[model samples]
Target: MGQRVLFIGLNYAPEHTGIAPYTSGMAQSLAAAGWDVGVVTGLPHYPQWQVHAGYERGHQNRDIINGVPVERVPHPVPGNAGLARRLGMEIMFGLRAARARWNNPDAVVVVSPALFASVIVRLRAKYHGIPVLAWVQDIYTAGLTETGSAGGFATRAMRAVEGRFLRSCEGMVVIHDRFAQYVQRVLGVDPARVHTVRNWTHIGPSTHMDPATLRERFGWPMEDIIVLHTGNMGAKQDLGNVAAAAARADQSGAPVRFVLVGGGRQRPLLEELAAHAPRFEVLPSVDDETYSALLGAADVLLVNERPGLTEMCVPSKLTSYFTAGRPVLAAVEAQSPSAFEVASADAGMRVPPGDPRALLAGALTLHGQWVESGGTRHSGGARYVREVLSRDAATKAFIAALNAVRTKGHAPTRTTTIATLNN
Candidate 1:
């Protein structure tokens, strides 16, 4: 048998969050590569803070997805309220994961999300004497502080906590190159311990449905040009500029129609704005089939990030946009890593965040160019995704990292025997 590897994350299977697909794909790939893989995650309750139907609260349940064993534990989903509730959920998962590790030794554990799971990783490392690979999706402390979501004493406390967590890890994996620099400069993390591995979007262009069929099913006009935004609609997204751009497109008598699909705290506001404007269409988040169809049906995939969010966030959807074979209109800082992808892929245009005029102008220009070019928005992004962001490439890199860590003689934190049962 190959080396046993474990993954710890807040959200996983049955959850349609960002980390779920990435984790599932990685686990499946690792398992197929002849490694013994196990996953530790909380019950699925994301985008909606309620436990998924058919799952009961308990220690955990084991299941196989795509040939890998997954272990799930119960964690509370604080219904979009207090920090204490959210912290409770994080702490509960951390403690349960620690217990699970104590029982199952010999598994190489990696913690994800970089915020709550970092604590679990530290505890497991300390208790089991295991090496942890910290996978950072967001620079949580900086992201929260810069975004004004955290302030004053809270920011200081979180920074100290997260800094310690980063320092405790055997190695760290970051999605963007700048994140490694940020870790070294801001958190004082060791430069040698950090690794930059780009995130992958496993979905490809072949999954796309016919545009006319998608339009007919969605009840959208085939004649109107669709500008689609799919993903979370939280504060970090800053979608007001998208609405403002739609309003501008309407004023110019353009046939462009804006479609905002996804749910978040900002969904209510987006729905309100769309309800008051005929040019805007707001839909709730849909399954992957519908999402792919919508992406295929649209002329452009719009991505937006609030000011200063580019450094803190690496929008995984950008990879999906590339995979969909559509141009992107990204409203993000030019200095962000996203800008590099846009330029490298020649996928689309970038406008300064929060500037409605620039956004409006860019959208109009791109729409016109796409139409003039016979509606060919292809920039070879899909090919780029297949070559660069494919599961094969990402899984190979992941396995290399795991092999490196294993070769270093890293061991699990603790080991205990459990009673064997026969069916």
Candidate 2:
């Protein structure tokens, strides 16, 4: 048999969440690269913890997505904010994934944010004598702590556990360079063991939609300027500033209208605030077609991450925004690596995070500049995504890392030294 690769992820398609796209894209890419690929995942029930409309409950439901075998195993669907229930879900899925591997022993990759799942993969790797690659989308404990979600003794214990489990992986894939550095400096992981594989936008049909069609569909005034923010609206987003900016822009008699899309814990509150502002519109969660069309309707894309969260998280939406070819008006920490990327690409401007006045000022400045130069928001970053961040490029990098691990004939070593950042 050719080299078989197994991918373990918390979310997979038919799930409609952020992780699903990445997991599905990576699986397809690996399959296209000639590796026999299998995905072990929990039953589809993310964002809404109920089995998707049609999938039956099961222990080993197998299906083919883009020619790769996907095995869906049963796991609990914990409601949001129940620690015990959430941990139970992770443990159940982990056990099922580990058991599934016994029948198909192969090199494995584990995606994280499910802390218990990482532990399970480590144990399974050791038991099966298979190599393990830990794909670190976010620094677990640090993310919780930075977002104020974990605290006191709980945070300490979780950190200790997370550090140990992360160090056990045969290889680690990180999305940000700062995270790689933090992992090396804090966890003593060797730099070489960690590979920086930034997230990419999987090219899809209809990425570009006609602006007039989008405007007509949304009932937007033909001459009004639209500034859109799309993605999960959670505590980490700090959207009050976005509202304040909208109010400020409106007061100044600017034609700019703000559109907020997607749903999360903070959606209700954002809706309440937006209702009081005539220039702002809060849209219900939309299906992919409508979502992409909405994005295409924008004059500017607004990205806001909570203040002080730069190193703790990276918004995956940036890739999509860039691919959509819209000028970005990002409100994030000045020091954030994401800010650097936006600035370096000359896509748009970045203001200090959580500063409504500054956000308003920056938006106005960009609007003025766009009008003065008679230039529609245009940037070469979409070309960058096509050339560097496409699914094919991500697959090549992923396979190279996997091959390196397999060739060493031993568990991969870790290195802490920083490398040049890839755009």
Candidate 3:
């Protein structure tokens, strides 16, 4: 029988937010790459925290999407979830999950952030006597620590479980250097068994709309300097500071406009923070055409994070930012994985995390530079995204590593590691 891989994750499409796009993409691409790939995911519901309109909590759904078999199990979707409620939800998923609805003959790749699902995936692979890989999209405990999502006891318990699941895997794939360091030192995964697979822009190429025309269409002033951030406005994002920076810029009489786009549970908090700041605009997400237009229309693409959010998931928005051909102003920690990615890609400038003054100053400086250079494109990020960090590049590297794991009956060796990075 041909080698088969089963992917387990809580979030998957047709949910439009968070990690769904990437997980769905990976499963489909792996199938296209000639592996027998099947996905076990929860029913579609994500940042909204409610099952999408077509799905019911008690019913199961199955479909073949892009040649990948997907079995969607029903689980409670809490309107507002804390650690306890989230765990209860995972318990429901475990109760409802039948054996992965596929003839899996080889391996499994489990994604996190329905992190409690790890126990089920690990045990299932062990029972089947097949290899398993933990695809560490987010360093679980570190993220909870940064977000203050759980109490100390819960953090420790989650970490212990995560470590056991990771170490039990035949291999692990981490997306960032800081994640790799944390996992190796704290989680005790063998450095040899850990692999780093950098993410690419999951969304397609931008429409490359004319900046002036697009800005005018959106009712934005042609002369003002625009800084736009589009993505989930969760606690870890610290986007309240964007409103703060907008207030600062307005008080200083600078022609700077800050636009925060996208929806999440934190959107209400963001709206409250920006209520008095006229220059700060929090818009409900627009259509894809407008999204592509906004990326091209802005003078700068901005990223902000809460202080003490040192290393967690590398924000997926950076990959999208890199594709827009605009300079990025990253108001993030010096040691954050996002900071590393910005510098490594040579994409844009960085400031200390959660500092509104610095964020304001950085945006103005970037605006001035754009004016000074007569808008000569600072297109390093676009070039890097296309040539170095394209989706095809990530796919090629992952397949090679998967092939190695199948051949060796374990994680790829150092040789495969070097080659994958080169891809």
RMSD of each: 2.9, 6.5, 6.1
Model 3 Cα lDDT, one tens digit per residue, 1-423:
256877888888887556887888888878777778888889876666767787777767888887788888888877776668888888677555535453544677778776677777666556545576778888889988888988889889889988888887878888776888999999999898888777878655555577788788777898888999988877888887888899998899999999998877788877887787878988886656677778888989988998988878798888888887788889988888888878877767888877889999999887777668775635578777877777787788777656655544433343344244335
Location of the lowest summed lDDT over 10 successive residues in candidate 3: 413-422
The candidate scoring highest on TM-score is: 1
lDDT of 3 at 37: 85
Clashes of each: 1, 6, 0
Candidate 1, residues 353-419, lDDT tens digits: the string is 9887787777778777777877565476876787777777787877766665554434432443211
State the lDDT of candidate 2 residue by residue for 1-423, as single tens digits.
Answer: 468878888788875546677888888777877788889887876554557677776556888887988888887775463556777888888977766743343577889877788798678576545678888887877767767776668878888888888787778888778889888987777788898887897534355578798798877897777888877777778887789888987888877788888766677788998879988888865676666666667877888888887676667777877877777888988888778678766678888888877887777777667667675554756876876667766777788778766643343321111011101
Please report how far candidate 2 places residue 402 from its true position, in Å: 0.8
Candidate 1 ranges with C-alpha deviation above 4 Å: 81-84, 101-107, 206-208, 374-378, 407-423
Model 2 stretches with alpha carbons more than 4 Å out: 47-51, 56-60, 82-85, 203-209, 250-252, 376-378, 407-423
